[model samples]
Target: MTGDEGPSYTVDDALVALGFGKFQILVLVYAGVGWVSEAMEMMLLSFVGPAVQALWNLSPHEESFITSAVFAGMLIGAYSWGVVSDRHGRRKGFLITATVTSIAGFLSAFAPNYILLIALRSVVGIGLGGGPVLSSWFLEFVPAPNRGTWMVIFSAFWTLGTIFEASLAWIVMPNLGWRWLLALSSLPTSFLLLFYKLTPESPRYLCLKGKTADAIEVLEKIARVNGRELPSGNLVSDHEIELQQIDNPSEDARLLSPRTNEIKHPLGMDSNLGGISSLSVLLSPKLARSTVLLWAVFFGNAFSYYGLVLLTTELNGHSKCVSHKLQTEKSQDVSYKSVFIASFAEIPGLLLSAVAVDKLGRKLSMSTMFFICCIFLLPLVFHLSEGLTTGLLFLARICITATFTIVYIYAPEMYPTSVRTTGVGIASSVGRIGGMICPLVAVGLVHGCHQTAAVLLFEIIVLLSGICVMFLPIETMGQELRDSVQV
Candidate 1:
């Protein structure tokens, strides 16, 4: 009577039949809106840090605190929300993050003191920390063959978000002030709230949790939206699909094997495990090694990527004495322009990733980009001319952006649906440690007359990250998502 008692069809079957259509398009738009909102919140720090420094007459150390506070909150949110999504449902996390980010970010603009502003920004970060879940949520809907490309494309919204924020800062900071920039940055997230009601919980998550009727209902809605019909069967879990494959014997079975180096399920995890138990799965024998390498790569990527973004303001502003226009321009104008131009470098990087992830494979694509990033940073060790320095930073930004996007696309594919969000969340939390440390080296150390040391530090860390990526256990180029940990 509940529509749950019947023979079942695999969720992947229904997804493939659904293909890409209006349902997915709406998912992309709403998810991209969330991506854009998080990017604006992150980029807000670089702009806000300087404005507040001048306004409050704070030192570099105090200014760095403004930037670090957000990362600290993100570190907590990433792991906590990851557990929450995996245990409760992905949809719950989406609604809560969007609501929290919008409210806190908008209120930060009205802070009476620097302390209050930092507190509000931290709360905003707690919400922004859930950003990685958007990728996990989006990927569940994509067909396997196109997942890499679509995920990379999904990440492109991040580039759009950064550029949009930079442009807004360039225009608003001069005329209105940082408060207006803060207030305006919070507006895009409102879009997520508007359209969220129309969105469904990830069907993959639903099926794995044994909510077959709910899963079928969601798929039925998707089928209707895409102008197609379901494949005429009940909804089933991934484990059931694997057992049926064992009896049937096909390419699907081969892909499910460990020998194929396809999707490696996190060993010894249960469907009911939540929070700390979910995290422990990452340390199981099968996933333990990959988890460590992923954490290192995440840390290095965050440190280098965020450090370079923050460095744009410092590096370009440092050149004011050398360039004719720079010498006459307002500090804010030069800062925003440098951030704007630097952000555009991410476009080609994202384009290359979209193509390379499917062609060259995840490991090679990520390793290549990381090495290239290190190469671009090597020139900055010694002070160069304004034009050359800006050019070098642009190229470096391209590679780092690509690596960051590819890594996010790659990580979720490594784990099963049961803990995919948790695995990514833990890795991202580790990455937040790097983000928190970036301001110190990028601004604090660089400002303290150790620019060469700062540059060299990033160069070494990035090179090691390239090596680390090559050791990831499996390549998830076109693999179907694993639903559970099975022998």
Candidate 2:
């Protein structure tokens, strides 16, 4: 009995000796910082869109191209980073991404010509390509039960960053100009790197790499943070560890192995898959239907969401006139203040999403939100009055934001851990293609028939997305992650 007790104490003591409580908080903080970096990258472009147009004398089409270029880079980056993270380690990929993105963001601000701006914006996308990898890394560390809630919280930071950018643009763009605003956005990335430096690598990543000792060390740190101690009997043996070690092999030798070869050329598919190999995996007969449906859902939603946002300044000229008239009695800050308030509306939606996602179930919540969004859009298209259109836009924004949040959470969970980030990255990249196309489409429609036509196109996209959402397999909620996929 004494010996048994001793072993238990040894395990517990080892964990206690590690001091994990403080460490886990630090990890969460690091994750939060990463979220902020992503947020800043996303929001900065939206806030500065008007300013860039003014400075560069850009037509709406050129502005769309600049924005689309960033998304294109992101699409490529997401796939690249996913593979890198799976091959290397999450922390390494994250650090490199932060460094490059921060540098690119600052450089983009200083871009002197349209070509240079496009190139730099693409670089910024490449830097942001690390987002899905970081998201996966954080998800793997947290307990399954708490995963949804934590992910929601992480996403909320995105909204917070949006608000921050909107506020900054309102204040700084007028005084310091848009370039300074772009430069200022890079500041958070530096803090993110510092936070990453202090945080431990993912325990799951360590386990995957056959580093059992290191994995245990990280777990002990987590246990300590949670104010719990590990039991000696519960301790895992090296033999019990499932991960395989590379055994210090040469790179060529490593690539020649069956496992590595399979990863390189999966499912006896094409030999020259190029960067599209990961995407090809999603197109398999088993996954093709889901893949196509998801693509449609994402495309439709992104087209509508981004189209609406991009056309915000154009919608309901009468309403803008009214707003302008009302603001005649208000300060110069009135428009800025209204933008700030609309930005904040995303906060509550995010918070509610974080709290309700797991409980409400992904498919149901998402579909319901989409349906509500469709209802809101109907009013916008038919009512056509300035005040009614503006009110409907607000309602639609909240609904669409919540639905998109569900898609982000649900999309990644649909794939296996092996290709989780890859799948999500490709999905997101596809959505960026839509993001690129939507604005152009809006511009064409608006040019032909004014804002009403643009609004109608958006409504069609939303309705299509909603219908696609209904067809998706509603099987992810409450299922164990490993067990989530049907195949």
Candidate 3:
């Protein structure tokens, strides 16, 4: 819009008129690159785990610590980057996180010993933790109607990165070893820095910063990218910009106030309540129930997803035995190939969920997928024949992968903007705890007792989480991001 006199247009018309073909595609591509970088950093640890164990002669407990440490860093990084993004802008925050991640990943490649490796992994976690926050920045720029699809499309890059990592492991591990894989993972981060030059700062963020002209310029760039002409309407005004910048009073007061009743609910006279009022807010009556529900959802999803993925490496090892058996009949490395193909199942799941999320609604889509996952996993627990189990596991993985995507989208949508990143970060941090624990749990399940029992427990958790999800405020579908929860 040119000035204050231009006619108002809906977000959809503005997006379409701007040229949805090339410009939006380019923006998505740019965002996708950063996503791939973040995903690579997040997942490379899984592929490298066995190699690290072998090279370092690490005990099972020590090996678990190494992986968990990175997630610990992620917990720190996610909140830190959110604060930074709020203070600075999304562009600078993205650039800074990308740079830090690249450095940390490269440093991890050269870690001299197991202790150093674990430390570096934690550092890498801090750098990579900014990914979700940056994704939020991207969402802020787009209109709400198109936001779900865009976020879904953006999420596909995560699977693409995982696919890339698996492919690289398939090709490079046999020849170059895992160190090379670790070193190579940092390469995508370099490319993202280059792509970022063409990407503009979030227009909404600019508006919040009182930069009306700059915000307008960013919006024009978005229109140009989408291939639409600028409307001859009044630019967003300073007053409107100021109003947009106003932080939600409820959230702000909660963060800043000294009142104990507002901050937390006392458990009982006998309970050991002390100086941790902020942490206690999580247990308050108004927020406590939702918090526990979200935690269960996150914990269950993480435990199930990571447990299965960690098992993939074991399956890959089993594939070698299958390959050996098939080798008598043929000559291909069929086991490795099977593992690679199975890892790729995530791609289609991500793409399909990306396209279907808004149309289906987050809760329905997520719960349906979780139910499908439970169905798929049941055969595995019965100890079906290897071939059948393998196929079922692949199918189960795809469904769970889609469910994971929905959770990421739903988690942020459920919270208000003031506590949006904080809430998601806390959930993510808790999920990381589950991730850290799942591997050890898997070890016990597969080695100590029965794999079926371990997997069954995971399925039960997923089912419970899905049930909990149904009780959530289901009215979030198609709703605008709010400044406060409407209890």
Q: What is the C-alpha lDDT of each candidate?
A: 0.85, 0.65, 0.66
State the lDDT of candidate 1 residue by residue for 131-178, as single tens digits. 878879999998787789889889999999999999999888889999
Which numbered prediction scores highest in lDDT against the true structure?
1
User: On residues 1-487, what C-alpha lDDT tens digit does candidate 2 reach at each position?
Assistant: 0222243222223333444346545666677777777777776665566467657777767876877888788878877877666556677878888888999999988898889989998988888878877777766665555557767776776677777877887889779987899899888888877667666776655553456588788777677677765555434322121112133335754555333322222231222233455566677665677778888877776777766555544444333333243442343354355456567767767766765688878876777777777777775544265455556666777777787777877876676554566677777777777877876765545534555566677777787788887788645675434311222
Worst 10 residues of 2 by lDDT: 237-246
* Model 3 worst lDDT run, 10 consecutive residues: 264-273
- What is the overall TM-score of model 2 with all chains considered together? 0.80
Which pairs clash inside model 1?
Answer: 8-234, 9-234
How big is the positional error of residue 400 in model 1, measured in Å on the Cα after superposition?
Answer: 0.7
Candidate 1 ranges beyond 4 A from true positions? 1-8, 242-271, 319-330
Give all TM-scores, in the order shown: 0.93, 0.80, 0.80
- lDDT by residue (tens digit), candidate 3, 380-442: 665455466557768877887888888887777665443445556667777777777787766
Model 2 clash pairs?
20-225, 21-225
For model 1, where is the 10-residue window of minimal lDDT? Answer: 320-329
Runs in model 2 lying further than 4 Å from the true structure: 1-24, 231-281, 284-286, 316-335, 382-387, 442-444, 447-449, 483-487
The deviation in Å at residue 254 for candidate 3 is: 28
